[model samples]
Each structure stands twice: as structure tokens, then as C-alpha cells.
Target: MVRLPTVVIIGAGNLAYHLALNIHQSQVKLLQVYNRSRRGLSKIKKNTGVETSSSLNKLNRGADIYIIAVSDDAIRETASAITHLISKDAIIAHTSGSVSIDVLNNLRAELCYGAFYPLQSFKKERDIDLRKVPIFLSSHQPKTLKQLSVVAREISDKVVIIPDEERSKLHIPAVYVNNFVNHMYTIASDYCTKENLQIDHLYPLMKETLERIFDNNKPQDMQTGPAIRGDKATIRNHKKLLKDHPDQLPLYHYLTKAITRYYDENN
Candidate 1:
């Protein structure tokens, strides 16, 4: 029988919670989960039936891999604290898209370190099928990269070997697509609430927007609406409608101008 890698997860945020559950369900042996507080640990422990630790010193040193699935700011500090506690042969990795792997490598020169970033926004309350999510792996060492790939493949089918520089660059568009787009939805929902309109009415349009992109249609080619059509009259009317929402007016103006400028320059 082939032996699966033993794992230890640090931090119990959204990503950590999901990773723990996925790893537990996988062939990997999840030894323990550690968080500074007990807030999120209980849920992870109860679901995964894995040991939980609040202290870094109490981490399982025998685990083959230690994944620091914490916030971007806390990754370095968390890795630094567990530098001496982890096994020398253990592979240390962080689950961050923007952060470089040097954050872990600089702390533990002897142990192999890399990144196991899942390019998906996680919410602890919602369950996600990680097999569909793309996981990006990076490491300076060839052997370490291979090892990380083995673990990554167990949880996700789409595993890509993306270096730090390229991964950081990808994060920019990721934020634009996910975060910025979600903020737009929030604004639109707020507008609907103010007007006493059903936000659900816009769901079909929103769904079609995503469907076009997934169908290999170019966003620029699919661009429609008053801004792209250069309909100044409709634009003026839309601006007038936003008179009651002073804060939202600037964003609406900026986006309209941006869209207009892009199409104009291309045409």
C-alpha cells in the first residue's frame, strides 16, 4: 500500500476551513489544525475529526506538509513562529495568490517551501467543490514542486505550475473579475432596494454575461449597453437617475467613460 503524505494546516480562516475538509476527505493524512484562537477551530475539528491546537509549538512535527492558510499579513509571522517546530524534511507552503514563496523559504532554509494557492474565493458557510477550482503550485526546488503537485492533484484536477511572478500578475485580473465585479453587484442590489425593485429580475442578464465569457466569447466583442453604443442621451438619463445616489454617481461616470474610451480607441 502506498503511504499518503501527512498534513498539518495552520490558521482556520475560510481557506483553512475548506482545505482541512478537503484534505480530510482526500487520501492525505490530516494530522492537526492550528489557529491562534478557538473561534474557527471547533467547526474544522468537528467536521474533519482532526486534532486542533491553539499553540504553534504543539504542531505535529512528523507531518510531511504544513500549509499556512492564513491571511496575507499573518503568513510570514505564522511561518516564522513554526520554523523550528516543523520537521526539517516537511514541506512548508502558503495558500496565497499574491504572496511570494520567499516568505516561507527565507524563514526555513533547510526545509522545502512553496505555494499551494487555490485561485478561488472561499466562504466558510458555503461548501465548494475544490476539484473544479484551479490550484497553482510553485517552488524553487524541482523535487518540492513535484511533491506539491502530488498533493494538489489529490484535491483538485486543475493544477497548474505557476511561478511567483506570473501568479502575482494573475491575481490582478482575479481581483478585477471577482472582487470588483462583486462590488458592482452590491451597488446594483442597493439601487434595486432603494427603488423597491426586485433584484432577482437582473439575474438573467447577469447570468448571460457570465455565460458569454464561459462560451469563449470575447468580452470586448460582447460589450453592449449605452456606453459602448455611444448613446449620450441614455447615458445622460442614467446619470440623472443616479442623482439620488451621490456616492454611486462617480463610479457610474468613471465606468461609462472608461468603456467609451476603450471602444473609441479600438474603433
Candidate 2:
């Protein structure tokens, strides 16, 4: 039988919450979780039955891996605080897409440091099957990379070793597709609510749009509506309708012109 590495997680936010649950379910032994506040540790401890701590000084020292799943801003500070607590031979990694592995570079002389970024949007309320989520791992040391890969594979089926420069580039497109696109949906839903229109009616259309993209269809090739078709009258009418919504008008106009210009140059 293969020995799975012991794991310790830091943070109890959305990504951390989901990661803790997945690790608890996997073959890896999740020894404990650490959060800055006591309240944040309650749900994870209750569900996973793993030991929890509000202080970094109380983190489990025996775990083979320590995953710092805190916010991008706090990753460095969190790592620095736990530097003296964990075993020197243990592997420490951060769960961030945009933040580089260098955030933990300060600890390289004494310990193995790397990144364990999960390229998926996490929401604590929503339970997602992480087996399909792509996990990106990176480490300066070959031995550390191998160890990180083993832990990543146990939690996710799709694991890739993406270095810092390349991984940072991927984050740009990720934000556009996930975060920016979600904001567009939020704006549309708000508009529907204000107009007394049932947003649920658009569910099928929204589902189909995503399905088409995932089905090996290019987004630009699948483009429809007045913007791509160059229907000037319809675009004018949409702008007019959005006149009351001053904030939304600029976005509509800008997207329309962008789509129009893009197709004109390409086609």
C-alpha cells in the first residue's frame, strides 16, 4: 500500500473550505486546519472532524504538507507566521492563481516551498466535485515538485506543473472568463429584476451559450445578436432603452462597437 502524505490546511475561506472537505474525503490524512478566527474553523472541523486552530502557533507540526489557502494578500504574511511552527522538511504551498510561488521564497533555505493553485472559482455555499478541477503545481526544487504533484493528484485528476511566469499569464484569461463574465450576468439579472422580468426565463439561453462553448465551438464563431450582425437600428434601440440605466449604457455601447470592429477586421 502506498503511503499518502499527511496534510494540514490554513485558512477557512471559500477555497480553503472546499479544499479541506475534499482532502478529508481523499486518501490523504488531514491532520488539522488553521484559521485566524475561531468562527471560521467551526464548519470545517464539524464536517471533516479534523483538528482546528485559530492560531498559527498551534498548527500541527507532524503533517507532511501545509497548504496555505488564504487570500492572495495574506499568503505571504500567513506563510511567514507559520515558518517556525512547521517541520523544516515539510512541503508548504499556497493556493493562489495570480500570486507567485516566490511569496514563500524566503523559506526556501530551510523548507520546500511551492504553489498549489486550483484553477476554479470557489464558493463555500456551492459544493463542487474537485476531481475534475485542474490543479496547477510549481516548485523551484525537483523533489518538492514531485511531492506537490503527488498530493495534488490525490485530490484532483487533472494536475499540471505550471511555472510562475506561465501560471501568471493563465490567470489573466481566467479572470475574463470567470470573474468578468459573471459580472455581466449580475448586471443582466439586476436589469431583469428592475424590469419585472423573470430572470429564470433566460436560464435555457444562458445554459445553451455555455454548452456551445464547451462543445468545441469558438466563442467568436458562435456570436449572435445585433452586435455581430451589424444591425445598426437594433443597436440604436438598445442604447435608447438603456438610456434610463446610465451605468449600463456605456457597457452596451462599448461591447457593440467592439464586436462590430472585431468581426469587420476578421471577416
Candidate 3:
């Protein structure tokens, strides 16, 4: 593998956009950017000043690494389609926490392959301190793992060689913290709109909640809520308030019951 491998990024979505930006920012050669559609191609080209292509056929086969930053459903399809397009020695990686390295290799039986999962949510417009984000690396071959890990370390200090078994475990907590928590935020914002309340009013609560999580023990050990406190009256009152919002009520009740049950076992 080249010291700083040349890269071809596939897809033009959030992950691709940010990955392209970071890869270039780290002074790695971002040779090409490809997307299935031209919709957001111009924006990425403008920001990175790198050549972009909407067609996979236009990709440079000589690039040292190909990072498929596409969606989970498209990982296999894109890998399979691009297998013959690149150098057989080129390392192909996907930035999916849930997808296995075997899937990438299976899709392209002979080529070197790996997973280059950056375990963080990305928004293209906002700058991320990539070093702070954990980039999980996995590969069937040690040379492939070393190459991918070298590429990963360029953008993140927290690179770890995680096997599929442990990588899948990491994805679970990632969903709990980022995806599921973000959904709760979405629900909160909608709730605020319906109740004539500003969602920003919850910022302090959110801030302190995060502070405790970071400052204290495990989330379960740091757990504090009416459910865990066994404050039945408060829980009842909260449920009554959500009664009119039937959609949110179910999750609230279910989570409350779950929290209560967890504490019940402890007590």
C-alpha cells in the first residue's frame, strides 16, 4: 500500500461528503468522488476542489483505496459493481457499522476489502473534529487491516481493529446513543411545536444529561428519572400530559416501564 493511499469515494450523501472533505483535509489524495446521481455532486466538488463524477465508469481504477460511503442497502451492490473497475490490489472499504467485512469480500471474492466505519453521525455543513470520532477498522487480511488502519488514523486517533463480532456490538450502543437519541430529539421538537414551547428550552436539560453521562459511571448507574426514582405520582402525571399525543405516549410508557423493570431487578 502507498504511504498515503489515493482514494475514490462512492456515493454523494452525508457520509460521503464529509468523508471526502476529511480525507482531503488530511492531505490524502482524494482522486475522485462518484455518486449515482448528480444532485449533490457540484457542492462536494466546490468544497473539496476535487474532481467529481456521477458515473462509476469514470472512476480511476488505479486508486489505492475505494471507500464506499453509501447506504447499508447499497454496500453490496456498489462493491460488486465496482469490483472489476478498480485495481485488484486496491483496498475496498465500506463505512457501515452494521455491515460485515465478509459481505465486502463475498461481493468481490478476490479483491482486498475491509470495513472503514467511522462511528459518528455526520452533517456535511458542520465541521467535525475527525480525530475525536472513533473509526472502527476490520479486515480478513492483516495487510488490508494495516492499510485501512493507516488510512483511518489519518483522520482519527481512536482507530481500533474490531472484528465483526465486536463491531456488531459497538453498533448497538451507537444506535442507542446517536440514532435513537436523535429520534427522541425529533419527537421533542415536534412536541414543542404543538405545545407552543421552544425546543431550546430543553437545551439545559440535554446539556446536563450529557454532562452526567460523561462525568459519571455507566448510563444505567447514572440513571435518574421518575421511573428509576419510583416516583409513581410524577410518572402518572407525565403520562396524563402525553395522553393527547397518543403516538408519543406509547414510547414514553414503554420506556418508562423498561426503566422501572430494570431498577426493579436491582432493588
Q: After superposition, how far is residue 199 of candidate 3 from its true place, in Å?
A: 2.4
Evaluation by TM-score, superior candidate among 1 and 3: 1
- Model 3 alpha-carbon drift over 4 Å, by segment: none
lDDT of 3 by residue, 22-85 (tens): 8988867899898889977898999989999987778778898999988899888988888988
Worst 10 residues of 3 by lDDT: 101-110
TM-score of each: 0.97, 0.96, 0.94
Candidates sorted by lDDT, descending order?
1, 2, 3
The per-model lDDT (C-alpha) reads: 0.91, 0.89, 0.87
lDDT for position 143 in model 2: 85
Backbone clashes in each candidate structure, one number apiece? Answer: 0, 0, 0
After superposition, the stretches of candidate 2 with alpha carbons farther than 4 Å from their true spots are: none
RMSD values, in order shown: 1.2, 1.3, 1.7
RMSD of 3: 1.7
TM-score of 1: 0.97
Residues 153-221 of candidate 2: C-alpha lDDT, one tens digit per residue: 988999999888788889999999999999999999999998889999999999999999999999989
